[model samples]
Target: MISINDLTFLIGSRALYDEANWHIKPGDRVGLIGANGTGKSTLLKIIVGEYAPTSGTVSMSKDLKIGYLNQDLLSYDSHLPILNVAMEAFERQNQLQKEIDELLKQMETDYSDDILQKLSNKQEEFSALDGYNIEYKTNEVLAGLGFSTEDQLRPLNTFSGGWRMRVMLAKILLQDPDILLLDEPTNHMDLPSIKWLETYLQSFEGAIVIVSHDRYFLDKIVNRIVESRKGKLTSYAGNYSFYLEEKALRSEIQRGEFKNQQAKIKQEERLIERFKAKASKAKMAQSRIKALDKLERVEDVDDDNPTVNFSFKFTKTSGRHVVRLENVTKSYPNVDILDNAEATIEKGDKIALIGANGKGKSTLLRIIAGTETFKGKVETGHNVTTTFFAQHQLESLHLDNSILEELQAFAPKHSDTELRSLLGCFLFTGDDVFKKIRVLSGGEKSRVALAKSLTTDSNFLILDEPTNHLDIQSVNILIQALQQYEGTFISVSHDRYFLDSVANKIWFIEEEKIKEYPGTYAEFEVWNSKRVIPPSKSIPVVPTKKEEKKPVNTNADNKQQLKKLNQDLSKLESLIEELEKAIKEKEAEMADPEIFNNQDKLSLINNAYISDKSALEKAQQDWETLAEEIMNLEA
Candidate 1:
């Protein structure tokens, strides 16, 4: 419905878009993706006519209606009831209703044929406009966006900015515009609300352009991916996952073509140099030189995937029992958060605390951090130093201090050089480290806060929505950092990709208690949706008459089986010992100066070592199985 033709936009001296063309046709579910400051949101605004392109046209029909949900909409304030606010989207229906009500009032007093005819006409128009069902549709959208029945009657101004944005989202959804431009819609949404929005968008007839860092949401909603990169819009005819694989393949092809072109250019350069001096070949050389000069060089792909290589500063290891909560009870004025809940956090556990909003996920994090009041026994294990990172803590950052200075103050033991190196892993390097915290953006501040949290000499970490306000790349960096962390942690986040990447266990609050699923977020999602009983649970089967007549074990048979188990265990133990010894000997050879110097010999020895290690593991497993069987027989 919208055509961006040769679009070029400039922010001062920077070209945000250069000859970028994208046609957002009807029913096109386009995911607009890019790193922060790449102008994805700006492109949406240009398409919606809020901003004009510097060089080209964003063409669409005059009849085409566009609904844009953006950060700027958070400034919208109203004292009107939320339902009324949302119902405003049905302007024609509401207007028709007003006329119908006026005609009804007139007919009550006059009851003439003219008045009756007018009333009938107005009622027909109102019915045709679906005025009677507008409120129902509005209420459904509001509820899907997480408004309770009572909340529908509440004033819009009473809601927080995030919730207000949701109200705006409900309004836009009620409009049923020809196209929807959503910029980070999931940022203000909880997982459930996000899911509801996803389902709603799936059946929506109009086109959608979503700029989101939530890869899971993008993968579920977008049928096409339009990546904003290097001042151009590149189209991918698939979702986010497909775009990733396709991009990698294209990058590889581009890399090869670039190398081949470079080699060809070098050959042409040599030929020109060799023949330019000869009178017979000078014309051909000149022609070749002109062709080379006019050649359009392929821009090299800058595929820099920065990873978090910095380590968490550890003063001491936490005990096996990181934290224990016994009979914990926490409540607000009218809401009971957790009542008599018990949970344990053990060392080396990476737990993701997740659920719908107002479920006390953050409150539980604070209770663990010992920063909130509750009726419970919360015991911190020995040497379990904790570092808590939350979005609210971002405000605790010293605005006057530079990014480097903030880190220096938080980690006084570390030198400025070490702090700068740590910040480099968070993507702050050189002059960026000197930027004052006040001048930093939300994402920048989040990176600094995360860097500070990681550098604290604490073995137990508590993070509340740490992935909030961070882009995909920053989230990936955090994921890498958490994956490498050896200590215990409980993080509250709605970012499914982050949770799946960093969490080994999932925790969700249910029935005023903390419930845990010992699996990744993706695994939990599958089991949760299916309510699948794990394979570990035994299914009892009644024995048939034929099965009931099976032979029973006698003393002699049991003794013979026990003896055989013991003999097999002993043999397996001996084999395991021998394999271990052989592996050590191979490793010793690998470490030798002679073998290490010879790559071929080292490869052979390493392969042998790996084989021995695998055999040792199998032998050990067999020994354990045999020993268990022997013990069972004796019992």
Candidate 2:
């Protein structure tokens, strides 16, 4: 739907993109990825028309509607409730509703056919636009994005910046434009919210071009990957995994080609040098020199992509039971966040705390860390020193201090050289360490906070969303470092890939209870899938005496049950696929200028499209439930 033609953008003397050309077609889900400072966001801005490219044209269909969610937080009316803010996306629907209300009031006095006809027409328009479902859809999205019904009614100003960002995200999703330009949409979302977004986007008809550091999110949603590097755009035809494999292969090939070319050039140079001094070989030498001058040099690829490399050094070993909580109860004025919650952390357990927002995952972490009071027995084992990294810890940094100073304050015993080296691991190098904390960007400050946390010699770490602002590389570095560390940690993270790599145990919190699942994140997913539809709590079926007298056909019954389940699963899958196809067909029809111009046809197709999408989502859930049941039965 949008075409970037030979686009070039310059930031001061640095070229962000040079002669970059890309085409985004309808239903294309592209994940824009690259290292930090590689202009991914800038490219998105150019596409969204927020910033004009230095050269070339970004052309789009004149009727195409684009929704751009930038990384920066939006400034909205703080007094307005979050639900109201989200509903603002359907401004036309809101206006029509207002008009309808006024028309109803007028009808009470005039009772005229003209007024009734006007109201009827407006109501039809609203129904055609699915205006009646606006509140339902809005609430659904808000809930999926981690807003409780009560929270929805709370004023927007009551939420933190991160939560406000989520409200903005809900608004954009509600808008449902033809194209989405999302930059780090999952930055503020928790695990459940991210999963909800993944499911939502999977059925979204519009084209999606996202720039996110969350690899798991990209893998789940994006069909194509585009890397912005060195002012050049490279396209990968698959998800992040494919991109990694392909990039490694390409890099290796490039490195070999470069080496071979360098060897040939050196050989030619040597031949010319040796033969140049001889009068008999002067012509040959001159020819060789000209060839050398005309030869194109292969640029060497640098392996150094700036990675953090630090490991936690535990000051002392903790007892076998590092932390223990019993009958933990934390409450607010009228709400109980946690009641009768119990959990245990071993000496070397790497636990991932996961749950929906407001489920008290962070509160549990704080309670265990002794930062928050609870009406329960919370005990830390002997020598269990703790290093806590809160979600907002970066925001609470000493602004006046430099990055170097911040780390120094935490690790005063370390030498200046050692401190600088540690900072370098976190991507703060040389003069970057001298940069004032107040001057750093959110991501930079996050890095500094992480650096400070890593400097601590603690046996246990309580981290809440530590990967929120770190780039993909930094996250990977952290994964590697954590893999090597012997210290135990309980981290609350939404990045599935990161959790899969780092977490050895899963603490799933639901209804104030922490259920422990002993496995990696991937294994936890498999286990969770099987249990999504719990086994029946009712009594088992008992055959009557007459039935028992006959040949017991248990095997036959089992086979029949399995066959029927398989058939149902297949039917649901087929129905979902058909619905998706219908939705896509309707979307393509809506994009057609002829169909778009025809108001009656547009309304019909739009309503059908919405219905098809809704059906597809339902069918998918049914398919999943059946599939899970089948798997359980077979096992």
Top TM-score hit = 2
Give the per-residue lDDT digits (tens) of candidate 2, residues 195-275.
889999999999999999999899999999998888988899989998888888888898999999999999999999999
Instruction: Give the Cα error of residue 146 in candidate 1, in Å.
Output: 1.6
Instruction: List the candidate 2 regions with Cα displacement exceeding 4 Å.
Output: 109-117, 304-312, 395-400, 412-418, 532-635
Residue-wise C-alpha lDDT for candidate 1, range 554-632, written one tens digit per residue: 7987776667666666777777778888977986785575664344686577656655665665566556555665666
lDDT of 2 at 230: 84
Q: How many clashes in candidate 2?
A: 1
Residue-pair clashes, model 1: 0
What lDDT score is found at residue 410 in candidate 2? 83
Scanning candidate 1 in windows of ten residues, the lowest lDDT window is 536-545
Listing every candidate in turn, what is its Cα RMSD in Å to the true structure after a full C-alpha superposition?
21.6, 8.3
